[model samples]
Target: MVLLERAMPTTLISMLAKIHGENPVVSEAKGVVPTCTCALMPKSGGKQGECKWCWRILVNREGLWFRVLASRYGLVGGRLKRGDRNGSVWWRDIASIRDGDASVLGSWFPENLSVHVGNGANTLFWLDRWVDDVPSCVRFSRLYDLSENKLATVAQMFSWGWKIGGEAWKWRRRMWDWEEEMVVECRSLLLTALLQVDTEDVWTWTPDPVEGYTVSVAYLTIIDRTPPTNNVLAALLWRKDVPMKVSVFAWRLFRHRLPSKTNLFRRGIIPSEAQLCISGCGQQESETHLFLSCTLFGHI
Candidate 1:
């Protein structure tokens, strides 16, 4: 675990802190749980330094973890889609991340990840972002609503023929002239989509296609997309020279996770009347007051 901690990038540590809902120091103390490092191992004859284990189950479809989940819950567009009530707690958590319910990590997956249609068996015809970086369902909402085969795969649609007057165009009702024009546009969009009969569909990490997905890259991408605020200070909090306890203290202070009287009252750990500065300054013992504004402690 210490070796894993050493292997982890500082940015990734911060990201994991956010995920685990704890300060980096506490998270580090817990240590990263062991996962299959087989996926992290470099391919035969590949670069020696390329091997690094990351918490990735989405893109590593061939990995044992992915295969086990896929076998149980099934997959759509090389991903586990929502609506599996029978899935395990872990699956639900992963689903939340994949479906954009887990905050930044959730949103990051869809925006930075994409699918390359090969055989198209693993690619959703409407939902996967295989064409032009946007899902067909999102691009052609009306057509998608009217279509009967909403869950159909790209290979299934192509096999049924996606062109005009094809069996793939199973609509709920006859479309008006304008809607038919949308169908025309949709068909034209699929004209260039050629599926490979021999190759399987694959997910591509858009930021680094060749190197593929890495937690470090994903963390950096999230940081980049996040509007800069206290980010600079947050980045500075994690330093090799600084003690872990100090960094954790700073992190808690910044995020209001400290056990200040105000925070304790807020969490129902104490009564409101008890939420006063320990120095008896009359001000609430909030983080700011205790750390920066208190007449007694502020001097130090």
Candidate 2:
């Protein structure tokens, strides 16, 4: 347990509690606030208005959104009821079946979510992302793809028996010997984790030491996904008093990553040879030749 006065944000530290299930309740920072403006309200269902942050939280199934939804729409009352704005209607609007909830959920709830399987009523057996930070279908795709009830919850699968091919054992689609073994293994894994019917399944955000989402963490997560850019010419490109659009173009030019005809040709997007410069120079156009050696261009 490495204690620190200031919090450090790293995917590694976040994965610690997730992979091992060592839940340490750290004291939240003083005067901490929810990343969402919805938290400011004494009570909320997001019916009247939801800020960008709250809407994102609801979409990701994180923070108050997850809690409210998991509580069977009883957590937050009023206009944001089951079929209302912040309920199933909101979910359907953003995460349609055609678009696939997995894609939408995946954008926010990456591998850092530690799903505490409780009653298993809401925790999907194969699809809802209950176990191992990934969907059971993804981990055991062979069995899941063949199984008839793809959206069945953990409770339903365990209680009524997993309806492979949507029928009882006598008339259900036959499973290969290996698939049977895999099914047994899958069942064993779920059964091993004692599900407390009294408790509801919870989705936790793991990036913060206190298990709360922060804008900083979210920002860093996005940066981590993007390829890093060189800062060598940043000072030159982002000069004081320069307009934003001009600075952006300057930055692109500095990096030689602009979608110019020559660059596009080099990237195989253009069929024309790289010899004819846009300025009509006879020499083969290159980043160095364009700005520095071209006979037509004035030196900066």
Best by TM-score: 1
RMSD for each of the candidates: 15.9, 16.3
Question: What is the TM-score of candidate 2?
Answer: 0.43
Query: Number of backbone collisions per candidate, in order?
Result: 0, 0
Model 1: per-residue lDDT, tens digit, 134-220? 788888999999999998999899989887679999999999999999889988888788889999877777888988865445544
Off by over 4 Å in 1: 1-56, 75-86, 101-106, 228-300
What is the TM-score of each predicted model, taking all chains together? 0.56, 0.43
| Candidate 2 structure quality by residue, lDDT tens digits, 1-300 | 113212423333335445555442231322222223222223322211222233344335434334323333332211122345554434443333212333222344334455577887756677656756577778888877787666666776667754354231221477789888887677666555677889876655566537455444543453465443555245434655567888887667656787766788878887876547767868767665665567876244
Which residue pairs clash in candidate 1? none
Alpha-carbon lDDT of model 2: 0.50
Scored against the true structure, residue 218 in model 1 reaches a CA lDDT of 53
For candidate 1, the lDDT comes to 0.64
